[model samples]
Target: MYALVDCNNFYASCERLFRPDLQGRPIVVLSNNDGCVVARSAEAKRLGIKMAVPLFQVQEQIDRENIAVFSSNYALYGDISARVMTVLEQQAPAIEVYSIDEAFLDLNGLETNFPLVEYGLQLKQRVYQYTGIHVSVGIAPTKTLAKLANHAAKQYPATRGVVDLSDPLRQRRLLGLLPVQEVWGVGRRLSRRLNQQGVSSALALADCDAAWIRSHYSVTLERTVRELNGQPCMALEECPPPRQQILCSRSFARRITEYRDMRSAIAQYCSRAAEKLRQQGGLARVVTVFIRTNPHSQLETFYSHSASRMLSIPSADSRLLSATAHALLQSIWKPGFRYMKAGIMLSDLYPSGSFQPTLFDAPESPAAMRLMQAVDNINRSGRGQVRFASEMLSSGWQMQRNRLSPAYTTRWDQLPVVRA
Candidate 1:
């Protein structure tokens, strides 16, 4: 058996963790710069505050309903998520971290001794008692069906936050009730096509011939069909696959109009992206930079553009990536438009030691490697004290996290104090 564990309203729960006063109240967590609604509590959802709606549009509702709002405090959320995962890591034999707030755990042999439902409840309660965050557990024979079971656990309160699809009869009954779009790997477009073909329910799609699915749709869809039919097509991936591409992007706290400000933002993003490449021991042959005005804003003139360049040799050096990214920015940036967001993408990556060196390319030097290591260690221990001179010095174009909570777990100064 495979089990999927998912946090309930993760971001909102993170916000509520420190502020127990806001419990059972309408609370929301905003995107970068407090722009749009990224997370909402059950109370906030009852008020009909739709996801991705701009903060300005919901001001009246917020005021009338006395809703509490918070900016995205990623530092706090990440620390909390790590703690939750640590608890699961201690309990499960093998696990795959699917996302920031979700994971898949292996439960094949353990179920032979105890009931699966009891194990799910134990996992759920242990997580809550340890991290103070509620989670739902779903168990099934396959990862895809486990995902479906998790959906059922969250959707229906009658399940009491745990669902087991190990039984074939329950699988057929539940899949019949769920729409085709709700099935794992069936996106909007594919679901629409399936609906048109009279496969409007998960059971209908599961009943389709495997060969016909492979011929008409894809091998991936055929696997999904098999999974829904109680066949284990997907296995528990204990480790994440290596990323082919790495992207770092964020909306600015304020609009930037000057070339120097845009230069700083691009360099910071590239430097961050390069650090990631080095962490993975990978080198990128291509670097791309993009900038754009806020589409939600009603500007006199709106514009968005991007530029990419292939390097002569694959490299993960921060200085080299930052220089190339700044040059790309100069080529695409327009003077008059106020740019609200920017990003850097590194692709065409190869393992650090596997790439062949070109005749004219500079070989990797020990001095350079040592310097990069020192920089990474210093920055990891102490935040951003050692960086390229080209990177931003002041708070010029950082994200606006005005209502951010303190990093209670990670930062020493921000740690909560107990008073007698």
Candidate 2:
């Protein structure tokens, strides 16, 4: 058996974890630079604040309706996600951290001894007790059905955050009612095609001929069908290898027209990417820097620009990557255009200490390697920031004015008060 565990209204829930007063209020979390609505609380959804609605388009509604809005704080979200995964690992036999707000657990051994429905609710209650974040759980014989059951648990309040699809009648009733697009692997185009074929629900698609699906929609669709029918086509994979590419990008809170600000932004992005690379035990041979004007603004002259540079050595060192990224920024930064976003992309990644030095390239010297390690250690210990030459700007390119709630769980100064 498999179990799917998903956080409810993840970003909004993370915000609520700190600001308990905001509970039951209409809150929406914005995407980068407060561009659009990314996540909303149940109250916000009730107010017709649709996901991805631009802030400008909804400004009047937000103000009139008294909608509480927040900028995305990934630092806080990442910390909370780590905590959630830690709790799950302690409780589940095996867990696959699927995303920032979802995981899959192997519940095969426990199913025979315990009632699956009861077990799912116990997991939810324990998670809530530990994290103060609500979660929904679904247990089924296969991953696809587990995913479907999870959707059902999230949708219908009667389930009370737990759903099991092991019963044949329950599985059939749920599948018959689920929309085509609600299936695990079905996308917009596939849903339209499925509807055209009169297979408008999950049960109808699952009953379709496997050969026709394989011939028309490819082998992947066939596998999804088989998985829906209690065969596990996808195995639970944990601790996959580090990524081949890492990208760090964000739109500015306000458009930047100054060269120095652009430089600072690109440098900061590269510094962040390098930190992630080191954390993943990977080094990059190339860094690509890009800057652009807002694509959505009519008054803004459209400008999308990027440049890539080869590193002297494949390195996860922040200083080296920041230097290269700044050089590329100098070549691309324009004076008059109000730049919307800047970013860094690291590619041709390999595990650190595994790559051989190229004949034409100079390897990182012993002194430089030691300095990098020292910087990383200092930053990790929170003694100071690990910064590079390009990040030496006094304060330009800092995340635009953040009126954020305190980091109640992650920061000492921001801890909540409790009565003894």
Clashes of each: 0, 0
Off by over 4 Å in 1: 294-304, 382-384
Give a tens-digit lDDT track for model 1, residues 299-359.
Answer: 4477999999998888888887888998899899899888888999999999887878878
User: In model 2, which regions exceed 4 Å deviation?
Assistant: 296-300, 358-370
lDDT of 2 by residue, 129-181 (tens): 99988999988988999999999998899999899998877988999999989
TM-score of each: 0.94, 0.92
TM-score of model 2 vs. true structure: 0.92
